[model samples]
Target: METSKETSSNLVKRYQRYLKLEKGHPENTLDAYLRDLDKLLNYFQGEGKSPLEAELEDIEHFAATVRDLGIGARSLARILSGVRQFYRYLVLDGYIKNDPTELLESPKQSQHLPEVLSTAEVDQIQQAIDLSKWEGHRNKAIIEVLFSCGLRVSELTQLKLSHLYIDEQFVRVMGKGSKERLVPISPRALDELGYWFIDRNQMKIKEGEEDYVFLNRRGAHLTRTMILIMLKQYAKEAGIEKTISPHTLRHSFATALLEGGANLRAIQAMLGHESIATTEIYTHIDTTTLRKEILEHHPRNIRYREEHKL
Candidate 1:
């Protein structure tokens, strides 16, 4: 018979493989889940219990200790989610008849809506660029690619020259978890990218760094922080007040599509969202635009207006 320690180790190893192969979780996410599970294992060991034998009270005690450790609401919620999945895995494998985490409730997270840029604001920022400087062309291309494709900052930074298919109007992107998807590129963005390439070819690129799509003046690929700083500078120059980031452009891309009557599932596909529910937040973000469309086209609204005409 296996000792409790051996059983626990084997279970954790099995769970890690499940997350990697079946769930396809990214490295950082998988690491976090494993750490959370380790916390649970430590708590169980203190009580002379194995995870398969943990009771509701044991889970509750773990939660209390986690809280006492001053974990933030968001982090605490993620940790609990990991722990719950662990219990669920045990039940599915027949190691436990019931999940101790079945009754667990995650803490409520505050709803913070993503900020989006208006079309005019976007135009103002891009138009404010000084194209005389060669770096200006590169910066313009960065902004266009970000807003046009709704790319994550990291994705934009790591984009390679080989990934772009200008003739096909598509750019291949390796998204979270190394999941590759081809995102459509707008003509305006493509035009700007072509212009940047004209200037890019003149630069003396560094060894082993020739394949990056966007590079700094020194020929190294742009960093995530540099993108954020550039956005902040442009936002100031455009006189837009609300705080913005590269992600603001991504949110704006989705919001504009939603307002333009694009299908939600199509938007989900373009944005590379794994779940439609994850993409549904845009519906909530554009309620005012949605209301306008309903009032303009709904049959009841049309009838009411027609009858009230004097």
Candidate 2:
């Protein structure tokens, strides 16, 4: 559970098992559901109740509480989804007579396009690195791999030296649910990693950490938080103001491919998205980009552009 959690009940454990063995929820998704469940249970505790006894009004109040805490609509929807699933399971097993979440209204979430770094912005960030520092070497490599390969931060952190098939121009990536896929590595990304290797090889590699590809000064695999912090600092130094995170690179990768005329299914496979629907979000970004370009350069829109200029 994230933030605050109440004592978990046996029912929660059983539902967790069902989600894993039966529903086949991926590991990260399972963790999210459990965390959301914690949030729900904690809220219910404050009401002198449990999820098993939660009323429709009680659920609505919980949703408002989550909103008050400033969770975004999409996240609130996910948390409510977890709650709905739990009640559904309880009803399925006859533990409850009614499903309180059945009529619950989820918050509306708009389809917002994610921020993408232009190739120039990417180069600017790379140039901002101070190569004299050892971290600069590793950070540069990290950014290159992230942009070039489009890995989830967890997948990147879990990457192993043996997973790199440099001669074949691919790296074996362990994606969500422990699934494996091969993502092509750009020469530029590989070259940065080569430089990072010079520093990595000289270190007294720690026991059991020898196989991991990216490491901290302590020789352990870099945590996901470390990557988040590093990217923010680089973004600031590069003076690109839009919010950035590991997912931004991944989103940019997909959008770039779509704009370059790559098949949507191909991009989905490369990103290891289980559903094509999950990969379709890039199309929205591509549409926004297309519209911007048309308004900026299309001869017919030139006057309109000038008229609309802020």
Candidate 3:
């Protein structure tokens, strides 16, 4: 019998190939699935049982253990989902006769909405960039496209100049799972991109990187970490207090559209959400905005606030 580490490594590689080639999962999803599987493999090793030999009780115990570890409901659910997919693949490829994970239940999902930036805050972040510097145009354009298009950081990094339709005002984005979508560009964003291109053109362009829309001074594509660090620096300079990330801009984009009366389904398509339920969190955000307005300006609430003032 092979050792747990050796057997699990071979199976994990096979599972990865299946997810990437057959299921068309993107790189991030592939990595997540692998991480999820590793957790189970570690548990199985501790119990001196092979993953292929796991029984229903073994799976149940695993789930219970994860819950007891204080993992969040959303993450626990995804872990179970990943494990199920792995077993289903095992059953298909003849490594196992039956999937032991079939009856396992994911935890009930909890809604953890991300913070949304106000339009003024978004502008303040952009304005924090100094245009006199060489990289200023590129950084400003990055912020503009992020808020304007509501793109995932990966999608933004993979953006290409060839996919841009300046005349039609749409940029073709290759989004999650290798899916493609055309997102409209605001004129303000377009002007920023135009400025960026002028800076981009002056560089001694690196081969194979010329087609990529956002490149560093070394003439290579920007990494996701670079984007995060840049946003943090600008946010501090802008004096905005809310915790920010690329997804905060994404949430802001969706919330602004919802408040401006854009259809929910349209926002769903723009955000590339596979489900409308994923996009519906903004409705809660919209409601939160309404409640704030009532608390601040409603006649009854105003009088209560004034009376309660110490």
Clash count per candidate? 0, 0, 0
Predict model 2's lDDT versus the native.
Answer: 0.77
Please provide, for model 1 over 19-109, each residue's C-alpha lDDT reduced to its tens digit, 9 standing for 90 to 100: 8998899999999999999998898788777777776556766876787678877888889999998878777766768787875556656
* Candidate 3 residue pairs in clash (backbone atoms < 3 Å): none
Model 3 lDDT tens row, 3-110: 334477788888899999999999999999999898999998888889988866578678867876788888888999998998898889877787878655456565
Instruction: Give me the displacement of residue 88 in model 2, in angstroms.
Output: 27
Clashing residue pairs for model 1: none
Q: Which lDDT values do the candidates have, in the order given? A: 0.77, 0.77, 0.78
What shift in Å separates residue 195 of candidate 2 from its native position after superposition? 0.7
User: TM-score for each prediction?
Assistant: 0.57, 0.60, 0.59
Determine the backbone clash count of candidate 2. Answer: 0
**Sort by TM-score, top down from the best:** 2, 3, 1
Off by over 4 Å in 2: 1-7, 10-111, 276-310
Pairs of residues clashing in candidate 2: none
lDDT (tens digit, per residue) of candidate 2 on 1-310: 2211333577788889999999999999999999999898888777777677776657877886798688999989999999999889888877778897875666768655668876677778889999998788899999888877778887899999999998866789998657787777765677899999999998777899999999999899997668888998989998989778887888777676667565555566667774445655544444334334323332223433465562
